[model samples]
Each structure stands twice: as C-alpha cells, then as structure tokens.
Target: MDKFILILANSQSHFINVIRISIFIVMVWIGGLKAFQYEADGIVPFVANSPVMSFFYNKKAPEYTTYKNPEGKTVQNNIDWHKENGTYIFSYGLGTVIVLIGTLTLLGIWFKKIGLIGGLLTFGMSLVTLSFLITTPEVYVPNLGGDFPTPQFGFPYLSGAGRLVLKDVIMLAAGLICASDCAQQIIKSKNSISVNRAKF
Candidate 1:
C-alpha cells in the first residue's frame, strides 16, 4: 500500500494533465452540438428564465406568450420564435467560444501562457453554467399535492437536468487546478532563465 501511494504521489502531475485533456474533449463535443436546431430548442427554457439571458427572445411579438396550433391547443411559442430569431446562430457563437477555450487548453501542453488563459476561461464558463441553479426554477421539483402540512414545494431536491448542471462545480475546481499548474510552470521557467543569465 505504501509503495502504491508513493507511485501515485509521484504521478500526480500526469493525472492532472489527463483531467485537463478530458475537460477539453467534453467542451468540444458539447460545443459542437450547440450548433444544431435540436440543441437550440432544448436550451429554450434555460435561456427564457434567465434574467441575464431573457432578452434574446422577442417579447413583444404575438408568439411570445402562447400560440394556438392547428389542433387548437395552446402551446408556448418561444421555441418557434427562438428558431426564427436566429437562436441557432447564438448557439453556434457560444459553441465557437467553447471550442476556442478547449483549443487553448490543449495548446497549454506546449505553451504555459496559453494554458493559463484557457484555464481562466474555463473557470468563468463553469461559473456561468452553475448560475443556472439560481435562475432556473425548472431545475427544482414541481409542487405536487400530497398531505395538507407537507406541501411538496421542492427546494433542496434537484431534478435530473439540475443534476447535469451541478457537474459544473467539478469542472470549476478542475479549471482552478489547471490554472495553478500553469502558473507554477511559468514561475519555474522564469527562474531557469534568470539562473542561466547569471551563469553567462
């Protein structure tokens, strides 16, 4: 056990590198999906509920409230309007930014400065995703009738989609770790350069 622990400790940096690469791959995959119409429709509720993001839709339009289909059933029309108003364009732009961050992170394997920038960007993106927990009420369990005293106005309980957003916390920590590693590398390189200059 002691020998195994020693080996693991020695390879800690390698493990961190693996985690960094894994995060980059996740970003690239999800970012690519955002360009599609299905993904644009899927993100509608999250964007509509967000105070910081609600303006993306045209609120004054007749379709903003509800639309009656040919069958005469009223349905929320945001999805249709979102599609028409270039939601896919917005999604594509977001995807591009995400891909750029991942690309910079991958480049960090060769350049510490670029890696540090990528790490910072990743951390910022994590914070944005995590913020949805506060702004998105859909994440919480709906109020279902039960007993008189026990109103099922779910607060602490997370829905399936909420759980997905929660994973950003882990990503945030990983970004911090990657940034710290890059900072250390930068300091070490500077010291080495200074020492070589002194020798000359």
Candidate 2:
C-alpha cells in the first residue's frame, strides 16, 4: 500500500499532462464543429443572451428567441436570420480561439510558458461558458403545460443545456490546475538557473 501510494503521488505530473491532452481533444473537437452551420446556430441562445457577448449579434435578445434552430432541424428563415445576426462569423472566431488554446495547452508538456498562457485562457473561457447557466433561460426546464403542472421546471432543474454548461465547472478546475503547475515549473526553472550561477 505504501509503495502504491508513492507511485500515485509521483504520478501527478503525468496526470496533469493527461488532463492537458484531454482538454486539447475536447476543445479541438468542439471548436472544429463550430465551422458547421448547425453548431453555429446551436450556440445562439447562450451567446445571444450573454450580456458581454450579445454585441456580436446584429439583433438583440428576445429577437433571437424567435429564430432558434434546434439540432437535427433547420429552417430557411431561421438560417437567414442567423446569417444576418453575425452568428456564423462570431462562431468562427470563437472556434479558432478555442482550438489555439487547446494547441497551446498540449504544448505545455514541452513549453511551460506557452502552457501557462493556454491554461489561463482555458480557465477564462470555461468561466465565460459556465456563466451561460445564469444568462441563458434555456438552461432550465420550461413550464410547458402538460397533463399536470410540471413539477420540475425552474432554476435548479437542469435541462440538457444546463447539464452541458455545468460540465464546464470541471474544465474550469482543470485549467487552473494546469496553469498553476506550469507556473510552478517556470519558477523552479528560474531558481535552478540562479542556483547554478551562484555555484560558478
């Protein structure tokens, strides 16, 4: 058991690298999807409702409520509205940033400085995404009338979108951990250099 514990304890660096790679894969895959019209249209609710992000759109909130393009289906009018709203353009830009961050994070295994930046950026991006839980009404189950007064519809009740956004909390933690690790490596490298100089 002691040996096992020692091995586990020594594996922290390896685990951190694993996390970096995991984040890289997720970011690249999701970001690449942003190039498609379907993915661009899917993010409409969160982006449109965001106070900090809404400026990217040509139209305002509530107006977007009328143009939502649910996955697996598309309407010409909805696509036209989204095109006019700068949805695709913003998505393309955001996607590029995400992919770059992933690449930077993956490079952390060899380049601590770049990895630190990537980790910090990942944290910031996750922070913004998690905020959608607060900014997006679609994150919660709506009180659609049914046979009975839907017992589960409100803030705490997570819809599919809410679940997706909530997962970013994990990403947020991973980013911070990776960033701190990189920063530690940088400081250690500087200290080693200073010590070597003193010995000369």
**TM-scores, in order shown?**
0.85, 0.96
Which parts of model 2 are misplaced by more than 4 Å? 147-150
Candidate 1, residue 182: lDDT: 91
Question: Given candidate 1, what's the lDDT at residue 162?
Answer: 83
> lDDT by residue for model 1 over 1-200, one digit each (tens)?
99999999999788878877987898899889888666665565566677777677644233322532322232357446655665667788888999999887777777989989998899998998888899877678777766779655667778876888899999898888888889999999999999999999
Flag clash pairs in model 2: none
Q: Give the TM-score of candidate 2.
A: 0.96
| Cand. 1 Cα-lDDT | 0.77
Per-residue CA lDDT of candidate 2, range 1-200, in tens?
A: 99999999999999999999999999999999999999998898999899989999999888988887878999999999999999999999999999999999989999999999999999999999999999999999998866865588888999998999999999999999999999999999999999999999
* Alpha-carbon lDDT, every model: 0.77, 0.94
